[model samples]
Target: MINYDLYIDGKWMASTGSSRIEVEDPATRQVIGSVPRGTKEDVDKAVAAAKKAFPEWSRTSAKERGRILRKVGDLMEQRKTDFARVISLELGMPIRHVEKWHLKSSIREAVYFAHMAENFEYEYEAEGGWVRREPFGVIAGLTPWNYPMEQITMKLFPAIAAGNCVVLKPSQATPLCACMLANIFEDAGLPPGVFNIVTGAGGEVGNCLALHRDVDMLTFTGSTSAGKEVGALALSTVKKITLELGGKSPLIVLPDADFRAAAEEAVYSVFMNTGQTCCAYTRMLVPRKNKEEIESFLAEEAGRYKVGAPSDPDSDIGPLISKRAFERVKGYIEKGIEEGARMLVGEVPGEIKKGYYVKPVIFTDVTNDMTIAREEIFGPVLSVISYDTVEEAVEIANDTPYGLDSAVYGPAEEAYEVGCRIRAGGVHINGADAHITCPFGGYKESGLGREGGTFGFEEYLEVKSVFGK
Candidate 1:
């Protein structure tokens, strides 16, 4: 079993408080590890460390910072197997999926940001003078459990690459990966206090970070309600906030699109990670005339994803992060039925008694006004709503409060036109893959700022114009 202490000032030390939070393996329902339950005192120490390190780290040469971050990325690559195993156990993701999606994706993001640090335009000419983008100093990164490492890295790497020091509060549910990252940075020889981690319940450490006087910026990734709380607190302190919140993202398939391909992509998009992703295409808009044909394709594709133990490399789907998540998803499934949406694919498996597994569920004949279609369920649940015309599909896609990510499949020209009309941060066209080079985040309530690539690097920076220069 893994045991962790608080990481402050680049040192692993015991928490000021005696409380500890036990980490559980959702698949086995067993205590796998524990981390210190950090208090306000811990947050103070961490923030103090970051505040101390910020001046020097922020002024450090971009090439030097790039070199160090690249080393961290290389070390992470060496420990990829360890990261994959630990995350699979902690988050109950299939080992292979963790390797591909979490470990590798995070490593790539780190490397991408590292390169951006050296190559990006830190200073550019303006109409009257020179405009410089400088670090915002001490940043507090509040990340969630679903994509623990990726979420942390998405915030941490870019912020650091832009020359900001950070205090990270990873989700209490999946803190192991964050602890491992602390070790990785130390091994890569990052300066003391440049990076720190405090693990505990959000009410304690997270809220403290949000309201801390020393914090200059706050970047959060989680539910919209939780984000609102964080944003409100951060706003009180006037700290710059970048939030990547929840999404009930939509995927549209035009009449001229490859029906079978779109259906398969829709299933893969929503069911990846058991549908816990914030930007998942949980709402699928298809043609009304091809309803049965689309349902058949979805069912066939989803059947291939076997729900089993996460340790099995071949397991296509794993348990939810915890019993709470399982129950939450089940409640949504029952709500779908109550709202008159027909279950077209799978049901909540009543036979699973051990693990917190929910069968990949697809609800057809779903109206845009239904709960299944309106709410962000954050489960392996898909709501397929039929639309008669392209304009109707666009309208249905934009009907939700969320505007995070969307997908379109059809003839290149038509899909591009449809994608332009959708109000989202990122839009994928014709089965395109997600690249680390692109900016990621949301529009509307889905989030507040952009992440990834140059946009992410800029998020941690504050612009100043030299008027007299």
Candidate 2:
């Protein structure tokens, strides 16, 4: 029975628009809550408040800003249980994973950004005189439904640490967690209008935020097509834009790699977060000689993933964010079948009965040009393509417009070499896990700018070179 409202300026208020978005639990197909369908008017009010807060907020001492961030982190940690529950219920993530990874990981990211801000050199002597990193004034942070807290924290923490005010627009599908985040900032005593949350459709609130004249920067995380629109709109006013868009990344399995280990890691990499991750390794490139063996192993491993209720502790996969996403994933599965890709594992549209569930799907003998291999499905679907040599593997991996992330699986030395040759921003060797302290982003259409560690902090800042005295 939680009543969600837009957090504009320093107060929680109802949207001026007549429209409202109903939040639903994908697993049960039940309406959880309703969020206001914010309009351009709402975006204007938020940007205005942020602009007004910027003068004082940007001038605040870095130490004080860091202190505030640290306090926000502490508050979030205290409410970890509640946050995890909300995420699991809203996003249909397993409760155990929500606690182990989503909630805990997001808190760590905030803490990491706070620590980085404390020691960051805002002003430093360089070649001629001094260089300073200044805040970009008001920033609009548009986050996605998947990894709601993580995405929000990734953008908002760094923006605030760099002394900028933020107007965050979390996805209407999972706006509850963002509301809780706003509560954390309020309880942490963040200055009025320094942080705001507005929930609505991307067409309305997102577009308005990007086109708002007062907004100095627009940070977006979503699909490539949506990103194109946001980028174009932001460019109209020439606002600074940081886009972490879609990725159809590749995971290369060298001939000498352990077939069992590679297959297991590949399935986990692509299927985690229900394959909704922007950088999910959807395309797997294996040596032609070992294709049959790897394909068999992948089929076996895919079957092991238990897809069911999010509340079930043993459930390995959950429902898509909504009915639309469910249909989209189902449609892609069907497309793979029609396009001549062999369905090596799982069924199309998955088990029928309830919710927005889709079983893990694997396609073998897939070509790079196939729709399943080329497009970003954003589902628990994997396409296995065979490559004749390491050179061909690199070519296939680099063929995609995205360069967000890629993985090299083989003997330690050989994998390292291949990783060096890959064009992605982050390369995982031998299934090495994602590191929070490292910079994360794509090289090409994957994204603009990074979103982790000190590299991420730079996105919220503008460099100014001071002339010699």
Candidate 3:
């Protein structure tokens, strides 16, 4: 059992750690570990420590801060197995996929920010005077449970690299890995109170951080509804806020495209993280003539992802995060059928009696207006919507509350042209790779602000203009 207390002011406090929040392994639905259910008092302590540490930490030389940030990545590499095991145990992502899916990006994010800290210009001449970039004090980082490792690193490294102190409250379901990260920070020689962790219910820990007057900025990654609540809560303080929220992104296949290869690639893209990704291409828009062919290819490719436990090396797909997630995804599949979308591949029921498992679902003959096509179903479910023309394809793709991420698989000119017409924050042309350095965010109700590379690093900074020479 991995048991931990609130990490505040560089020490573990267990006086209020009696009330425990149990952590479960989704693969077995077993209580594998637990962490303290922190209260508002704990949040207060964490915020106070961060507030106290801000002045000195923010004033530290950029090079020195970069050195610390680099050390963090180095320590993570040294203890890579620990991070993989804890994150896999909590998130139910296959351990075999850890190094590739989670740890690589997490480590790279830390290192990327380390370089930014060392080389990024903190002050530069603009117009007639010099402009300065300064860190905001006491950043409150609230992360979701889906991609626990990378999400935490995404929020943490950038803010710290920009010289801001942080008080983080990770999803209650994934605190063990966050606690392990805290241990790594301590060994990396991060100064006392520069980084703090408070784990508990969002209403208590997360709400407290959002409401805390000391928190200068809030960065969150989760659902659109929850992002609204968090953004609204932080408005009272009028602090800086950035959110990376939900999406119902589309994959458009033009008439000239290689339908089979595109369909197969789309299968891997959508079901990569068991379809829990916020920016996954859930909707596949294909020409009506090629719809049936694409559907057959999608089903064939999806079958390649075999479901099993996280510990099973041969397993390509693991269980959903919890009982609630499993049931929610299961409901989406049934709802798709009820709403008149034909299920091409997938099952409906309690076949695997144990873990929170749902077979990958593929829906064809789906309309843009149908509930299955519009909503963000965070599971291994794909909806294929056939359009008559290229114009209609772009229209159907953009007809959604989300505009996070999309893809177009066709010839260079045609794909680029269609991708330009789609109103998404990002559009991948012909299966292009998503680099960690690129800016990532959304449009419309998806959320505000961008994350990754310089865009994300700058989110933690404040600009000041000086008039005199």
Candidate 4:
């Protein structure tokens, strides 16, 4: 079992490691590792260190910072296998999926930010004076467990590349891989205090970092409710905040669309990561005339995502993150049944007694007003809601409090047109292949700011106009 201490400044110590939190493998319900339970004091020390390192680190030229960021990405790419193994072991993502999606995507994000850091427009002449974009000094990054490597790097790489120091608080359930990443940056010769890791419950460590006076900005990814609390705490000090929160995103299939392809892709979108994804397209909208056909297609595709231990290479899906998540998802399934939504396949018990596995569930006869259709059930449960017209489909799609992402399936012209009407940060035409070149975020309660590409790199900066300098 791996035991990790708090990473503060350039050192790893047990000063605030008096308590410990066990990391478990959801597939086997086994204890894989443990990390220090950081306290408010630990967060303070981390913030102080980041604050101390900010001036000098931010003063470094963008080219130098870009070089260091690129080195970090290179090291990550070299050791990606190691990262994939640890993350899969802890989070129950299939090894193959972790390797294919998590590792490569994170490496690309880092490298993308590396190039943007140097080539980004930091200063440009204006009518009266020149506008300068400066680093926010110190950043507090609070990340979730679903996409461990990507979430951490998305916040860390851009913040650091923009010359801001960071204090990261990763989900305690999946800290080993994050701990390994901090070591990777250290190995890349990141300056002391420029990057720090404190592992603990978000209520304590996360709240402390957000409310810290020295911390200049907060970037968070998690549930919408938790985001509200984080935003409120940071706003107390009027600190800069970027939040990527929850979603009940929709996938609309027009009457003329290929029913099989739409249903299959919708299954992948909701079932990927066992539906723990924040922007999962859980609500699938289809034409009322073809409801039966779509339901049949969904059932067939649902059987394809076999759930098993994370170590199995052929496994397409794994267990939920923990027993709590398993129960939560299971409860959502039961609620769907209670609300009169018909289940085409799967059950509330959801099979598999050993692991926290939740079998894929496809709900039909679902109305827009049903509880299952409205709430964000972070599980492999897809709610199929039928619409009479494309206009009503667009209306139903945008009815949610979230506008994170959506997918439209139809002919090129109609699909793109429907996508245009859908209110989301991103709208995939016919597939759900992850794209990094575009900005990713939400319109309303889904999130406050965008992440990905140049937009993400700019989130760490603060603009100032040098008057006639």
Candidate with top lDDT is 1
- The clash count of every prediction, one per candidate, is 0, 1, 0, 0
User: Which parts of model 4 are misplaced by more than 4 Å?
Assistant: 350-352
TM-score of 4: 0.98
**Which digits, one per residue and each the tens of the lDDT, describe model 2 over residues 1-469?**
4568899888999989878888888999888888899988888888888999999998888788888888898998899989988998899988877877577777787778878888888899988899998999999999999998988998999999889999999998899999999889998888999998888999888988888889999999998889889999999999999999999889999989988888998899778789998888899999898899998899888878888899998998888888888889999999999999998888888554678888888999899999999899999999999999999999999998889999988999989999889899989988898877898888888888888878889989999999896
lDDT of 4: 0.90
Error in Å for residue 78 of model 4: 1.4
Clashing pairs in 1: none
TM-score of each: 0.98, 0.97, 0.98, 0.98
The true-structure Cα RMSD of candidate 4 reads 1.3
Where is model 1 poorest over a 10-residue stretch in terms of lDDT?
A: 345-354
lDDT of 1 by residue, 256-279 (tens): 899899988899888989899999
Candidate 2's C-alpha runs over 4 A off are 350-352
